[model samples]
Target: MDEVQVGAGGATDFARWTGEFEAKVVARAAAGDPDWARGARLDPAVARSVQRFQVGESGDGANLIGKADRAGDPVYSAAVRLFIAEERNHARLLGLLLRAGGQPTLSGHWTDAVFVRLRRALGLRVELMVLMLAEVVALRYYRALRDGTTDALTTQVAGLILADEQRHVPFHCQRLRVAFAASSRPARLFAVAVWWVLMVGVTAVVAVDHGPALRQFGVRRADFGRGVFGLFAVIVPSAIPLRDPVRIA
Candidate 1:
């Protein structure tokens, strides 16, 4: 059987993504860890924001892996596992950074708990849709963290995560495009409409919740909201066939 017929579509080959993920792993190993010894410092508001994000990064990977296994593709399943590892590594890096800053990681965050539960109730297709929302928001969040901060260590970590996230968008897009391949025109429209709404809601929450930190780093809350929306509009259509990607003017 072909790979696309199994948990993929729109000419997306999970094998290709798998290869890319594998290469990333190799590159990451070669690059070694970020200069963690350099230490990091953040304002109180920023530290709080980073702590919440750190909690968000460390998530229920087993839930996603189970869904991927049920999707019936070993290659995709392997890739998902690798993807989970990358996320785990991110959490670890953030935790170390927090310690370096003389702060403790939060044991739990209510929003992360809710987000994890929401994704657990979804199938691989819908789960990726929800996960993509976080990914897009993260792209902007990390970018701001990278460019807005004066801390070298924070910038390094943010840049590393941002590069991985840039790859993640297209990785999911290929599969989501496949998942929506069979939907009718109206169905696709409705799904996109609902997705856009959810995206807006989540982005708004993040902007408000992290407002003080963003402001401290010189990012306006409204601008963060606009940035993710712009990024989302561009890629949203790529996940659904029969629609052109929206251009942000």
Candidate 2:
């Protein structure tokens, strides 16, 4: 349980998130990994659920990396590279977890394929906004796996991934703040409005798509959607959101 070093002289070295991500790299290396030998057990519904998530996590991230490089911010690019690595690691961990449960990683999911294509079509700022939707949903999904499941190994894996995601939300938010720093208020508000709409649609799709596994983990579909909505509400305003992210009841 050794704490991950966040670099020396902890006086907020991660003004741009590179320091924080670096600390995560060191911590993950030092921490090694969950004991895979213990194996795992999951319901068929949950196994399928994990498979879809594994595919989502397995993206190469070259697209995002290229965009980050184009932004001309070395620090942000560095942080993004590390971020991609973490995401890759998530895929790896889930793949191994699937193996432990005697399951196989999915080749691909249509939703992810379309999602990747859409992200590639957008600028960095917009792409990250889309990506943030996934991150927000993940924060809750992983929590359900960790807290709702009785399986020890599953809990361990979910806890680890969840920890990374918790950091990811704000990291993206800070970058977004900088990305939009020069935008006029009206423009920023428009983007926020559009972003809110996307978040809502994606949340509903995920809630329905993963509903079975969520119920197995004691989460209702409505609850899942609401949880994401609450998180998105806070995130929207924090990241120059459009008019406080109205929930519309």
Candidate 3:
């Protein structure tokens, strides 16, 4: 499949991955290994949240590209295409990690429904900014796991996922820059407001729920904080300059 063109939609592949992952999770759960089961369970909620985030904004991102294509915004279109592809890959990686850990794939009904509503209510720029916030949270979570885990498989999976996520940083930042560039003054202020809300909201949710889970996995919560801060430092610098026009393709 050409990377330049959006490949056939990922729904079919995503379904297959979901089924296979659930089966693996069920098997692991039945094995009666608490550590394994618990570790695996982490994958489900995380996957559900991510699935919601992606499905919610994917169409807007696509529509943006479609508009850019019509308007001959090749650079933006190409970047958006890469963004879509990265999101698709991200969904797959989350599924894979869940399966490897032996957790069931949670029903994404709520996320899907939410995405439907989000499509109607939000613009592409707002949606994309929200996605960046999600990714920032994910990068922190994954990095924490990768750094704090002693399990070889967990570390391996986390590392692999992190690699893909790292690639997304630039794509998301570029999209944010483009969106900012195209926005009017009022829109820019609104975008900043929305971004602040998302970032704060996501951080709060992560702080509340993630601590217990990490403790269950024998990971120190402080270590998670360190990982998150480390990621924040790196991502903030990279994302700041994104307001400047740069060639991403």
| Clash pairs (backbone) in predicted model 1 | none
Model 3 lDDT per residue over 122-239, tens place: 5665556556665666677666667656656567666655655665665555445544554455655565555566566556656655665565445565665555555554544344
Model 1, 5-84: lDDT tens per residue? Answer: 11223764588888888899999999999777777887788889899989998985999999889888798888888888
Candidate 3 to native Cα RMSD, angstroms:
10.7
**Model 2 poorest 10 in a row by lDDT:** 1-10
Residue-wise C-alpha lDDT for candidate 2, range 90-203, written one tens digit per residue: 999999999999999999998898899999999998899989989988988999999888889999999999999888887777667667766777999788889889988998
Give residue 212's lDDT in candidate 3 (0 to 100). 56
Candidate 3, residue 144: Cα displacement in angstroms equals 1.3
For candidate 2, report its TM-score. 0.90
**Winner on lDDT (2 vs 3):** 2
Model 2 per-residue lDDT at 37: 93
lDDT assessment of candidate 3: 0.51
Query: Higher TM-score: candidate 1 or 2?
Result: 1
